[model samples]
Target: MIRELYRQYKDRWLLELTFDRLLRWNRWWPQHRDTGGLLCWGSDKVPPDEAAHTWQGAAYESGLDNSPMFDGVPFNTKTNQLQLADVGLTSLYIADCNALAELAQVLNRPAQAAELRQRAGTYGQALQMLWSEEKGIFLNRRTDTGQFSDRLSPTLFYPLLAGVATPIQARRMVDEHLLNPAEFWGEWVLPAVARTDSAFTDQNYWRGRIWAPLNFLVYLGLRNYDLPDARKQLVDKSNQLLLKNWRASRHVPENFHVSGVGRLPSEALNRSDSFYHWGALMGFMSLLEQDKAVELKKTTD
Candidate 1:
């Protein structure tokens, strides 16, 4: 996003201003969250009065507050991280490194760019270990027990965004998981949890709801590969989701039902914040798709 901002506005000063802080944040993840070289979501010590100071704080850091992925996962107080080495956190960190590296290059800092690229490569290698040939997708592993979490979410597809999954691995993931009706793919599409998972019935926040950010991130990842069919489906369905609510109540929702059952944000089961800006990202995906189509047409013309 920062890169896009710089690209659109050509603001060198803005990139210069934010570069160091972004670099620090990229560095902080591995330094503090590293568990056997793969990252986990963690929290630093906080005051007793802090509501999220516990394991819940670590979950908060994952941005999936109540995801079943962390259910009964132990918190390593010693490391201040969840015992699970998260595929999502590690993949996102790699993406951050690559993004920061691009910013470093733009700022004419070759040494910093090299360092960031090296960090991304090292972590990318570690992330590859999370891939399960049997499952045909990456799984989060418990650092304590070295067991893979059976729970799955859209975050697993983040490896594509990080450019870590090989073409074959990416194909397997898409064919066996992403497009599977029993899992993430459906009429509504890309549920936070697989339809087969018990959590899907909850239809609560992260349990099985469709989140715009998840769809957007996964959509970005799909753009990295040759899956035009999947990409178009995602863009079309995301646009449909946005329009369905917008045409009904003139509201963009914070999230949507995985089953495509709700129309208004006021619906109790939907549990969405009406008119949330993030929800508009569903529409933004279509805009991006349209922009790409125009660019392709111009090139072919």
Candidate 2:
């Protein structure tokens, strides 16, 4: 779909901006590790002295906002180096590179397409290097020590979205990790943090809340692999959670309590944008469900 968009409208400002961004994304170091490389801060953002020692220098770039994954990791804003390489970021980086390569090919830039494709393949290789057979998941690795993080988050499955995982790997991720009752699975599904992780018990921020966008991306990933059953499970659970909240309060929220437990909290900390656009992903899921039903009916007939 993204490739089609670029092909259809390469002259548009959006694609131009996208091309420029991918061209400049060289700030990320993909060769430093096998699982992925650290994305350094742009030279304009951090001073050389502060780039290696403080998380305060760089805002946590992963959307989890205040995830505990960076609790003690030092970030250098000047050089854009953190001690760790994120599996999610790496996988997405590979996907983006591949997308840009396709765009370049559409624009008749054969050399540019080849370069971007090579870069994408390299990043994909590093992403695979980060796999943990023991955990049945891809994990973040320390840039300096090559250690993997024990904490798990919904973003852990992003390799599927990036097409960085092989069929076997995706199957393990889905069956052994994603659907595991002790991990991501819950009544509403896909918490920001795994249910068994220590952070899961914390209702604060990205510790354990359900975010609409993450689930939507994971749903797309499942569909990419033709995992219709898994995809439907996520779509149904997501829509159910959204409708339950909407029926009760007549609002779409920015995020929600894990599993839709209890009433959507009224506390200031728990309160979110009452009508966030992303929460309307439930409507999108509804369309997907409808399409699936139509397809099923056709098959039966």
Best by TM-score: 1
lDDT of 2 by residue, 148-181 (tens): 8888877779898889888888999999988888
Query: By lDDT, who's the top model here?
Result: 1
lDDT (CA) for every model shown? Answer: 0.89, 0.72
lDDT of 1 by residue, 193-225 (tens): 998999888888899989999999999999999
Give per-model TM-scores: 0.96, 0.83
Worst 10 residues of 2 by lDDT: 34-43
Model 2 scores what on Cα lDDT? 0.72
Question: What lDDT score is found at residue 59 in candidate 1?
Answer: 90
